[model samples]
Target: MPIPMNAEPNDGCEGAVKGAGENIVAVSPAALSPDDEVALRRAIGELRRESLAMRLTALIGRQIGFIGLMVPEPIAETINKTAESALRSAMGIALASLGDRSTRDRRGLHKSVATMAGAAGGAFGLAGLPIELPFTTTVMLRSIADIAKSEGEDLSDPDVALACLEVFALGSSGAANPIERGGALEAGYFALRSLLAKSVSQAARHLLDRGLSNQASPLLVRFIAQVSARFGVVVSQKLAAQSVPLIGAASGAAINYAFVDHFQTLARGHFTMRRLERIYGIVMVRAEFERLARQI
Candidate 1:
């Protein structure tokens, strides 16, 4: 999708994204040109579509776990271990990737994610849960960091990097919870919205200036992981999908693709929302988001 270069504050919204927008006291719809209106429509449309997709994947991920349970007890336990290990590895690599942006080939990175996902499936088939998990997790987190960068954040700043990590929580929206009718992902986005850096600026600031690695206190790392677990139900679902024998290398590859792409969309819209909040004020953007979310 073509990203809007100059558009701000009016990107993704819950309700109709036409005719410029409603007039705010500080900014008027009269200022919007025809092109701006079109861009807003496209931007909001993409966010809505991606949000819906994330919900669908979450629902599907939950159901897939039972199928894996059909496997033998011994094998199931092993797969679970693999899944946890994969997540740990992915978490480390993804964080490391954020520290460097000098050598980036997003296209190449996409290929690498696919390749790793495919290889894991082929080598272990349904048994390669450990390998598959890390591939998708790492790739999605990297995509999150990339989205942060596009939203004008410096990944070098620990606060920005922490925000990217929190995108994983967005996945928790429909995990095992009763999705609010049509508002699964939408509701999830709102729930975690407060957890984002803008909403949690004070906490993020402390982590930003402190040494990330050399000075990263155990207290801080533990704090981040604890906050992260608040939305960790979805991670369980993703791991559950590993048990499906029906999805081999090709299946694994497809799942990884969807996983990364879904987060990329989330990160894009999320960062876009933050950018909008900066221009139009947090209260207005959030109110509009909540309103539009109901429609979704």
Candidate 2:
């Protein structure tokens, strides 16, 4: 005899009896229960709005900062126009990737822009506001890259503007290899040498232009040799992963701080004392690099 659906087994067992023939369990096609389905939809909607707002905010901040730093009005305007176009292209790409067919809220984007502009105006209005040209330029470049990423665009292609950034952050040896031993130490030395070379080269050019050609030759030769040595260090670390944050943060902070010479001196000492500590310091400085990257 067949066991009933609700019957317990009588063979000294307290559990329900198994069916003799094949038994089938039916499952609904929907993975979520009705309440869960509604909750999920609400959550997704909120996330989409939040993401859009954050991107908009970053775009506005970057654009305003770039424009505010330019000294010449015409040049600034030209650069601003070009930057705006680039931003639009990036945003379009992002929207398409997200499957968002709706047009973006221009008013909202403009509002963000206006707010940033106002803040910039107030900050620059103060007397003796030091110019942060390099930091602003870096921010603009990062913004452009972020836009591209959000649009699902591949900035890793050699033809892309973001290739330099990718190489700086992820390393130039491609994804398959690990950093070579002693590469980090070499990178620190090369970076310092590169700075020294730039300083020397600039000084030489200035002296030569002032009709001190005789004085400039010796300095130029020394700078050339320094640059060559720097190149050797760079080559040694060529296979290593570039810590984007470290370089970016250090450079950015150097731009903002007034006593950059003092800071650089301290940095050199740190590099000499401990290689990992130097790298960590650089990473800490460029903490914004990752956050800015994710915005795009």
Candidate 3:
């Protein structure tokens, strides 16, 4: 059953794909259960509505309180270095305790984000980067782990756990298309999904068997470094937002709040599309998704 190009998008409907004269769905011949189909459709709907430019605009946009403040070069470098170190530490801890994290509610995670942000923002550099950096990084790592759980990916397995690491790397991907209008945003989303989707499992296996750094495949370690760089970009922007004279802890906390919140949304959307891809075939979903993207 070839779906006509003119057919209206029902959003909630699980349409079929033509195959061998049999009415086969894209990923299976049998129809998906109502609940599963609904989940799939909802995920697809989100992908269609997600705007690359809008997300980028929000990421790079100045914080309301410190719009015109300029970040000094040394201060910027400190921000990036601290963030990179934090992320490196975070990855080590996550790997070591991969299977040991106890069940946690999102409420706990939310509180953690606020607490770290509050502490980091309260006196920030006044208290030394050592104190502030760990607090913020640990909080972020835990939040990212929670996001992995929500996505139905198990963190116990090295393969699955590495995927969570990739999410942080993908966080600051808004630079590609800063324009609010045009198809660039949609194209950017697809490009991002493509980059992160392949080689995750393979890379994870290599990392686990090789143990931490030095002996680990140079290529795999490099990939992890690249991900850290993405996070570094975010940290740089955040320091800029919080660096203004008299900006205070409240403003810094606000910036931290936005940072974690943005990544959580990213995980949800990415996993949703992944589920849909498993069910409907990536080619089909991408084609239809791109079509919807063009319309939007």
Query: Which candidate gets the maximum lDDT versus the true structure?
Result: 3
Put down candidate 3 lDDT per residue, 1-296, tens digits, no spaces.
22211222323334453322234444332345576555555554443443333332354464522332255666656656666677667777755575746656473566456556544554654335655665666666666677566656556656555656666665566543312345443445565544544445345546656655632465565656666666666655555555546655655555566666656555566565555544655555555554444444
**Global Cα lDDT for candidate 1:** 0.50
Judge candidate 1 at residue 261 and give its lDDT: 60
**Backbone clashes under 3 angstroms, per model:** 1, 5, 0
Q: Model 1, 122-152: lDDT tens per residue?
A: 4555555555656766776776777677766
Which scores greater on lDDT, model 2 or model 3? 3
> Model 3 misses residue 42 by how many Å?
6.3
Lowest summed lDDT window (length 10), candidate 3: 1-10
Tally clashing residue pairs in candidate 3. Answer: 0
Q: Ranking under lDDT, best-scoring first? A: 3, 1, 2
Best by TM-score: 3
- Candidate 3 lands at a TM-score of 0.68
- Model 3 residue 46 CA deviation in Å: 7.2
The model with the greater lDDT, 1 or 2, is 1
CA lDDT of each prediction against the hidden true structure: 0.50, 0.28, 0.53
Candidate 1 segments whose C-alpha is farther than 4 A from its true place: 1-62, 65-108, 111-115, 118-132, 175-187, 195-203, 214-219, 227-232, 293-296
